[model samples]
Target: MIVTASSITFITPQVATARAFYERYFDTWSPFDCGWYVLVRLGKEPDAPEIGFMEPRDGAEPFRAGGMLNLTVDDVDHMHARMSSAGETIVIPLADNPWGHRGFGVIDPAGVVVYCHKAIPASDAFAPFIQKGPDVPRGA
Candidate 1:
């Protein structure tokens, strides 16, 4: 099957709070508010991945904890500094990972861990495990 677009919907009782958190931190994204649900698009492009926030319904439960959202950025340091200056909670400090990334984590209002990172050269231990797919772009 051919996939046209991609998105992840998070169930939360505090939809407005979640929406405000994302809007404040992730400025590049544009949010489409729909009262009970909000869809935040990464870009103006139609195929851009959307991060959605929706209210729990019909006995559905909200996400309790341990949810992670990985966001790839051009500059991890700048992003970290910006969030830090904004008084956002930083659960993980900026550090280089052996798996070829420099990143930090921030917990949102809904208890979701948002990891903002940038790609870097992998260490010897993880280099061999890094494989490039046919359609995947190089230097990613």
Candidate 2:
């Protein structure tokens, strides 16, 4: 079976700014704005969560302990502009990669990492995740 109803958590030092970064850049993304936790929907359907923000931790438990999330965008530059305006720290600038993608990075509340990026040629930047093994064929 396929995976459904999953949330990738990002630990952050600042929650409000992290929340703002997503609200400005993403397209049609609705996030559950709880006081401590926030869940951002990245899909067209009613129950598609692209990313999420957990409660803040005392230390870098999530990032140092190994946790991060990614959400591909249509325009990385546009996102950079908005996020910069929102004063979200730019962990990395939008640029082309040797692996074939134009992307950038941002740190969010609860110590979570929110990556906003787009493909250089606007193609399958998420090919690694979308691709399945023998159990799930490419065309199936």
Candidate 3:
């Protein structure tokens, strides 16, 4: 299992500005930029980060979405199961989605929406059903 305690989430208005700020002022490195998001590298091993800039679409108003936290986990299923067994409140069920990834979500004690995700492997395409749990290919 590849797990790490890292990632800093932010609520920004202009993603471009945030990207530029991180790249120039912070000297942060980011190779991938996509719709509504940009992944910046903090020059660390095991692919961990110290900070991040997130621009929510609904950030224009005074009231913003609550329980907004992004997280990446090694095994979402196992983690969800364990947490559920411990009486965790699951707002979303364990399933795959079109965006890719097979996982579920739950509101923490602090009412934070923690999305536990596991990257799906491509090799597992041959499986009976390809749930959105994992977007990357899994290998034997």
Candidate 4:
């Protein structure tokens, strides 16, 4: 199947606040404003994934804490500093993990988990999660 574009939509009571949080923390801007719905993008890049926020409609359940949004970046350390300076809640500090990543996590205003990571040399513990071939998967 061919995929065109993709986004993760969040339903929140604080639509404007959530939108602003993403804009400030993720360095994104809203391109589409539909009153109750806002679409945020990283920049002018065509392939950049859009992060959307929407106000809950009637009969809609309130937002809850679930799932995670993982974004890979070039420098997790720089991102950590920038995010901290911006007052974003850093749930996890940047550090090298055994899974071959230097990463950190921040909790969004809507209570969604967001992680930023960069690749690094795998430690010995990474062997279980690494796949050797198409037919063989690790950590099953």
Candidate 5:
């Protein structure tokens, strides 16, 4: 099966807050605000990933905790500085990972963990696990 597009929808009481957070932090995203629901697209391309925020429906459980969203950026350090200066909560301080990334984690207003990172050379321990392929898309 070939996958075309993807999105993640979060049920939260603070739909507006979540939408505002994405709008403020992720500059490239465009939002489709619809009162109780907000769909934020990552880029101008039609196939760009989207994140949806919606008010919990009757008997539906709102997202409380225990999930994370990984967002790769061009410059993790710059983003870290921007978020820091904005007084955003940095739950995990920026650090290098053996799996080939320099990243940090921030908790959104809706309690979702957004792990922001940039690619870095993998450590020796993880290098063998890293794979390259012809079908893999190149250049973010």
Candidate 6:
């Protein structure tokens, strides 16, 4: 099946705070707004995911640390610089990983981790242990 659209909603008690944090950090504006449920579209394309936040319903499991919102970016260094200068919470400073990515991480207002990264070739020291793939996507 073709995936037409997508979104990842974080259930948190800090709805307004989460919305404001995403707006400030990602430069997004909400197109759909509900007091405890907010949706912020991140891209100009029609199919872009509408990242949102919702309040945990009664009897629902309490918020728990699970997955992260990983954003594949064109320039991790640039993002790191902007995030650093803006004084956002840098959970992980910029660095290359064994998985062949150059990236950084930040903690949002709700304490969820947001990782932004750009693909890169693994360093020679780490190359043998890692699988290789196209360093850049074709036609990118």
Candidate 6, residues 114-134: lDDT per residue as tens digits?
899998986777666654356
Clashes of each: 0, 10, 15, 0, 0, 0
Could you tell which candidate, 1 or 6, scores higher by TM-score? 1
Local error of candidate 2 at 109, Å?
2.3
Residue 75 of model 6 has an lDDT of 74
Residue-level lDDT of model 1, residues 1-140, one tens digit each, is 99877788889888788878877766536557878888887656777668888899898899887678999977889989988998989999999999999999998877789999999999988887776986765544
How accurate locally, in lDDT, is each candidate?
Answer: 0.83, 0.65, 0.58, 0.82, 0.86, 0.78
* Winner of 1 and 6 under lDDT: 1
Pitting candidate 3 against candidate 5, the one with the higher lDDT is: 5
Candidate 5 TM-score, true structure as reference: 0.89
Runs in model 4 lying further than 4 Å from the true structure: 131-140
Instruction: Compute each candidate's TM-score over C-alphas.
Output: 0.87, 0.61, 0.42, 0.82, 0.89, 0.77
Residue pairs with backbone atoms closer than 3 Å in model 1 (clashes):
none
TM-score of 3: 0.42
Tens-place lDDT digits, model 3, residues 8-68: 5555555666565345422357656674666666444546565444556654432144655
Query: Which sections of candidate 5 miss by over 4 Å?
Result: 28-31, 134-140
Candidate 5, residue 102: how far the Cα is off, in Å: 0.6
TM-score of 6: 0.77
User: Which structure is stronger by lDDT: 3 or 6?
Assistant: 6
Candidate 3: where are CA atoms >4 Å away? 1-67, 121-140
TM-score of 1: 0.87
Candidate 1: C-alpha lDDT: 0.83
| Over 4 Å off, model 6 | 123-140
TM-score of 2: 0.61
lDDT of 2 by residue, 37-102 (tens): 677776668866666666656654544534556777777888788888878777877777755567
**Candidate scoring better on lDDT of 4 and 5:** 5
